[model samples]
Target: MNRTFNAASTADDVLDGIDLRGRRILLTGASSGIGIETARALAAHGAHVVGTARDLSNAQAVTAAVLSDAANGGSFELVELDLSSLESVRRCADRIADSGPLFDVVIANAGVMATPAGRTREGFETQFGTNHLGHFVLVNRLASRIADGGRLVVVASASHRSAPFSLDDLNFERTPYEPQLAYARSKTANILFAVEFDRRHRARGVRAAAVHPGTIRTGLGRHMGQEVMEAAIEKLSAALVAEGQAPFQWKSVAQGAATTLWAGLIAAPDEVGGRYCENCHVSEVNDGPLGPFAEGVRSYALDPETARLLWRRSEEMVGETF
Candidate 1:
């Protein structure tokens, strides 16, 4: 029942003919790249957009960019949000909640990729803290105000397939922490969050989905050293050449934003809830070993039991319940 789209498709293409006039949408990390592109496309189709960034200046720049685009006929507003801190999450959610009208869509697209081992304000590992825990608390705080038919989209990564869940060392407190492993754990948590959220909230008509925005160049790579990046690029190029394919197979930012747009607006509601998506499609679960990015979701990421357990654990960690 899963459908497929490709890297060549744009956000506008996925959103074709979809009228969103008057619908209120909130996008995190909207200051640049895919989040900004998605906001522009949504606004162009007439949705009222509230975009959040860590810096007021960056948020304003994004807002100005959206307003300057002729296709974006609807209005755009900016808000301050620092995902690394739970207090910031609370304040940001409180501010949005106080602003009145409910949001029809919430896109948790802000994220940090592989970074050096560290912890958040709450003492959780940085990747898990910012990418998954922040969004978890944000959604729970805003649950009351999310419209009946609203959608919550968590922008995950195919990298989640790189590692299975590690319940014992989720924080890397005892185990030697590898940055990619930490990131993969966080991404797994993203899928688990969506699956459990949908399980709990879908009965009320609100749905949640996790998306893998195809490998695209973005600020998420800011943490990597230049040598690491060059090495990665070289490996990718060699792999492409070995397969007789073009080097730099990643999509443009606009192209990368298509799956998020599709999951947010186009895919059949019943067809997608609780599933993992990439390249604008619900990925088919592969039975055997995977090749690099082609690895299917791990059992831990998809297990309902694990999802529920993680949900409870996350609530305990954040000291907040929905």
Candidate 2:
């Protein structure tokens, strides 16, 4: 049966009773918000977690917080990873690869949203470069080291529903770039990346899935102006108060991490690979416009041909074949 959870369900709730002793997990963006909460849940479940962030100091702080509250026998290690740079991704992966333990789950959770237009070190648009391409390269580089039945969970968004893949101007070279469009494009690429990854690796006992964590109150909104934030709040307030919908379409950090935990640790890889998931289950595919908290996958985001093209382009840009 298809299961559905809500914004109030925390990572612990999804992970309750799961025994993960000896499992090793790699989590990105572990310094704050959903990433931190997810790390806490995994560590509490007895996984040997290696959590990464841009700053070693911040990563250490997150590690300390998790370890302080960890159940007996839980552990976490910190690693440095800057997703915006291919060199950084390679170095981080190389370090973990040399660590001698096969990763059982990889959560690609760090991301920026609606930030001012910029370019990564490799000259790709910042959002597409960091949110999708960075993780794409990281996963491919570490693919062989992932355990045979491991899971790769890409933290995508409902924003992908806002726009389909724009192949012609993906790098924003020929068009005026909009932050939302760029974010949507990167998220679309995330789904496509997973589709192709699963196609190539599933037969080898590796599986990939993408997830929408739902809107949550986090530093992810720091880039927006007050008016933009207020407008979003107002819309959400109206949805709950006036329309009798789920009140205030935002999840707490712990709640926001639930679907990711489920996808990473609970869902059967063969049953869920290459699909977009939310609320701890495969979301019902929708064709209409997305509601405040519900969204559907677009055809372009799941197109096999586009996935292959993006994979090839990623390799060309990163100068590494996978």
Candidate 3:
């Protein structure tokens, strides 16, 4: 899709003049980094925001000053949501659903990257359970409740290009667990989830889009040391050897959140629904090493058949249907 923003664009830059008053939005991982900035920019524009964090006390401490930033009487509320736990995801969804406002936008911006191997309470891979299936359950719980013409934004990653997800062993029960591979698979699931969500709900006027928040320095790396993260980057850079491509550049928290804001608030619904966005535009499906800012979404992540299959799989995993 043709767009009006880029990597250097901040959340406020994309939100300029956008009157978000009365728009109800739920943002996950809002206690820190890009999530805070995204919540701040929308709140500054007069939107009502419910920001979720795993620890209520910590989130409250980090955001004690958040509500003070809102303009035009916009308000900010903090809620507990541990996406890694299905029970917590359900409780959070229930509380939000009972809050009386159908969300105008749901930003699934919370995620973990390259963490050491582990499983959620449900025994799914850590990255997949938290980043993909958790949000899958949360959104499904809220699907019927989102406002018509609303947006659901999944923050996926360019690492989805690193590997195709293995449907045969989604839990890694058969394959040995590798951190980067698991992370890539989870991210691919993010894109597929968005693609299928759009196909299923666009007719009802609810749209979904996935985004690649450009490489950024954040607490998302707290588990893996900088050297380990760099090792993963080297792996990607080596993949470019035959194609002669450069490594990805980094962005600040504000800039990292630009594409999410662009997809959720700035772009027209039909232009981006069911698409993967990067550098603030609908990205091409390119999974190979390529020129600057031309990184593509993998075909597997956008495959309608795989998306449907994953949908069924996710429903079974969560013990629910949308």
- Per-candidate TM-score against the hidden true structure: 0.94, 0.95, 0.93
Candidate 1 regions exceeding 4 Å error are 1-4, 70-73
Report the Cα lDDT for residue 48, model 1: 88
**Tens-digit per-residue lDDT, 67-153, candidate 3:** 878998788999899989999999999998887678999999898987888989888889999999999999889998889999999
Candidate 3 segments exceeding 4 Å error: 1-3, 230-249, 291-294
Q: Which lDDT tens digits does candidate 1 get at residues 1-322?
A: 4445676888878877778887899999988779889888888888888988999885786557676652545778888898999999999999999995999889999989888989999899999999999999988899888899888899998888877786777888889989889999999999999999999999888888889888888878878876888799889889877887777676788898999999888888786788888878787776468765563666677789999999989998999887
lDDT of 1: 0.85
The segments of candidate 2 whose C-alpha lies over 4 angstroms from its true place after superposition are 1-4, 239-247
How many collisions between residues are there in candidate 1?
0
Number of clashing pairs per prediction, in order: 0, 0, 1
